[model samples]
Target: MSDSNTTDFTNPSTFILLGIPGLEAAHAWLSIPYSIVYAMAILGNFTILFIVKMEPSLHEPMYYFLCMLAATDLVLSTCILPKMLAIFWFRSREINFDACLIQMYFTHCFSAMETGILVAMALDRYVAICHPLRYSTILTNPVVAKIGLVVVLRGIILFFPYPFMARWRPYCSTNIIAHTYCEHMAVVKLACSDTRLSNYYGLFVILFVASVDLAFIAVTYTQILRTIFRLPTKDARLKTFGTCGSHLCVISCSYIPSLFSFLAHRFGQNVPLYFHILIATVYLLLPPMLNPIIYGVRTKQIWETLLRLFPPKGG
Candidate 1:
């Protein structure tokens, strides 16, 4: 471990990440599970992108949004997993200051992007279910492209201040980060100066993004459910609801852990440090690993495409 007393306290060249406080001895064992999750996330999301690209029938709005989701998952997981595994497996815990900022930006930016994509997906379902005759016209290829652009731009613009915020602060305190990655709060907390502005800004971003995006998603799904129930046949209703099953599962996976981590960091004073770190780390990884599996199993088209691409033998 680098000695804080000897190093320049104002601006250390590199910040030392502790991986997970209170679990240093178990780092090697913990790396195994995290590595597995990262591998699965990589494979699953890439497969989703590949299948959606190669299959002509999946070139519609829903699948296109799915591709966006997969890509976002890829960015979100990749932003942290490799560095985290390095910290755990090889004891490579030193991260350059600018690099840390970069990681923090991508981590939060893609998280916001994921939320926006989920909203777009909910809207897609709404149009498809409530107005089947006008679904195609409502979500045209151009509109979908525009929506994708907006999601990407929204994240980029919203998070562009994160790096600057962290960079402007003078880190005269210790250079050790208790978390695996350079999280926004963790980095800003190291600053010697007042961090109330940074802290409140972080809270504002979280509330603004989560509240607006989740509210839109809630309203969209409410309309969708109302439409589904209006159908006369039980079979029609069941099938219509079935299409949203995978999305609902994905939404739960994405938001629940995320909300818990966010709230716990702010309010869970009694929670152990390692527990908070573990939840935050898993929050970054678990959804990417689960999302592809959920869609593959629950969506008929994706499942059939997967089987066709890699069929079982001994027929």
Candidate 2:
């Protein structure tokens, strides 16, 4: 949606998306599975959310962040999955310009915030494993809350400008975004202006944000590895690695699709539209799908708690 208030650039009256093809051709058939997955994604994340909140043992800083991450995934999945599924099922996936921008903002906001949270999780694991004495003091509830606040604030600053930039551009014709949703670059590409500045800035921001977070993560893990190596016992080493495996798994799942999408979209010319759709959806959906499983399966405390809460129905 163009800024109605802005005088310099007239907004594009409409934008188009290249939705799931062959299926958009047969939305009736596709929508069913799409809707089912959408429901599953939402239900899955919400279940983790409730479990974390109700269980006192899971109320520690790590789980608290995990819950927050789950919540972000809830937002992320709910935003994209539902709509995409509907398009697949019903063949009526129509989004207005303003609505698309709103979705775009939320999409980026939650995704960006999750990155920051993952970084925080890495740091938490580092302290818990390597610097046990400072774990409590370093990862206080208030501190975690502050970190969350920072995540949201930065997401807003980073995302808000893009829509306005889009709005400021003059619309030569109705714009269409291939692959579903008002993807940042897709929308930006349609802008009837020199997008070099915005593109460059976006690239820099992506690099800066991911690099900083990943750099810190690298540093934390490096120190953690060093500490683990110094331990004399095999059990100590295993325990140390075990504590971090979940975060590492989640981190890898989160970034791989994102990194691929980033490179593919920005640099991979001649890449098939379907390729983009698949990778983009993966980046958005996989994290939420795997997040709970990662924590639930990897961490014994969570698994044990869950198992105890609902033992085998019949002995």
Candidate 3:
């Protein structure tokens, strides 16, 4: 092929995100519903953060971990949605290389941090249920602060290599990203260079962080269940397990879709491209939308407080 027919691998600049292919005519209409969902996610998470911060009774370790999770959700949703909305609303899909890398960094970093926070929340529940006497001692304010700091640092350090890896690649291929946002694998696949190292690092990070955290959470819940089952009273068991319902719902919402999207992306060649992309978008968007709602509905304290703060009009 002639030089004019080939792309410049060393100096390509911009990437175009084709949002929800085969639906170009409906992009404007789709933006309305997506914008509503995005608004709910921001409002719900911010409300959770505000309630946890302003309510003195919610100064305990569990609420502290919840505040962290809420903040992570806020950042994650904000990172993915604004650009997506711009694409849907105004048909603006062009993203600069540097800008895409920044988005990639925050996307992975906050995701890992959210997983870390979930693990910390599980630990708090384990201590509360399995070792009630030691709960306060184990998860003190200083300890909670340390856990938050570690979660933030781990995310930043582990995912910092993502952008650098993408930057090192020579992208002579097409720059149109198939998804709505800049994901690690999506961006890596656009490169002209060998991406084995980058791909491996990405996989290792996911397995090391998310997989391990999920495993640990499982073990903690197992211990919690054993302890609850051993309780003398049925009401005690019901009450103890009730405390976990919200976390269970949040965990299920966060991990199940994400795991499915990852598996489908890597292995399910028979699946339609739009299905994979849609599931991936849902994996990112749904957790932020559902978590606060789960917590609000399942946790009696937060629900009661919310009602008290904003009473019904007829009441």
Candidate 4:
């Protein structure tokens, strides 16, 4: 905890992660639910990917975006959960510094990718609902491919600096991070150097991405609602609105906890440290776990496909 002037300013060989600080005694019990959720996330997302890939009928723009989302969720959760489980169940808390940086990069990169995909999905729904006649021509296969590439490239470009920024800082203080994984800000905060630049850049990225993406979603949904209200029959309006329910649910699942965790980290001065850690953990776990379920339950096509793929024993 010494200042840089007094302490030798050398990065430690390894950083120790104290999983969910102050909850060490319950780490074993905590691992149970964490393990279950991780398993479910893996299983659910993989199923979505498999079904989408195998079903010729699903080779459309919307399902393609869902596949991207499932893949992003897989990477996002995998980047942290295994190490987290190690910390909780086996007391394996030491992480190589370089490896930690890699984990941080992938975690944030895919998170941003997920956000981008949600926006793309909003656009898809907007077109499907608001411009039903042109939906096919507007979201052609090549256009969908380009959108996917843009989403990937946007995340890679924006978050690519995070690890390098963290690496350049001099971590002369203690090498123990009070979280399960190498979160970008958590790692950067360990540095002894002035971190205002890193802090401001992080804030800027969050606000820029969130504000622009949310604004796009808001505009698209506004148009979609207007189009739906103009429909002639009540059933048509209900059916059209139903098409967006799953995306809306997934967006809520992904953004609400994420926004809460980010705000809690930055401004929740009176919030307990453990609560912040727990919310951060849930923010990562909940969306991946719920996205597939939301889609499968709400989308008749996916639900029917699942039923067809796994017929009842009596039938």
State every prediction's TM-score relative to the real structure: 0.97, 0.91, 0.95, 0.96
All candidates in order of lDDT, best leading: 1, 4, 3, 2
- Between prediction 2 and prediction 3, the one with superior lDDT is 3
Per-model RMSD to reference? 1.5, 4.0, 2.0, 2.3
lDDT of each: 0.92, 0.79, 0.89, 0.91
The parts of candidate 3 lying over 4 Å away from their true place are 1-6
**TM accuracy, model 1:** 0.97
CA deviation > 4 Å runs, candidate 2: 1-13, 21-23, 26-36
Encode model 4's per-residue lDDT on 1-315: one tens digit a residue.
754333555777788889998789999999999999989999999999999987899999999999999999999999999999999988999999999999999988898999999999999999888787999999999999999999999999999999999988888767889898999889998998999989999899989999999999999999999999999999999988999999999999989999999888879999988889899889888899999999999998888888899898998
Candidate 4's TM-score reads 0.96
Tell me how far the alpha carbon of residue 205 in candidate 2 is from the true structure, in angstroms, after superposition.
1.8
Candidate 1 local accuracy as lDDT? 0.92
Clashing pairs in 1: none
Estimate, for each residue in 1-315, the C-alpha lDDT of model 2 and write its tens digit: 774323243564455565754345655665565566667767767777777777888888898888889889988888887677656655444677787888888898788889988988887888898889988898888998998889779878877777776667666544657667777777787666699977887787788888988898899899999999999999989977888899999999999999999899879899877778778888988888888888888888878877777687883
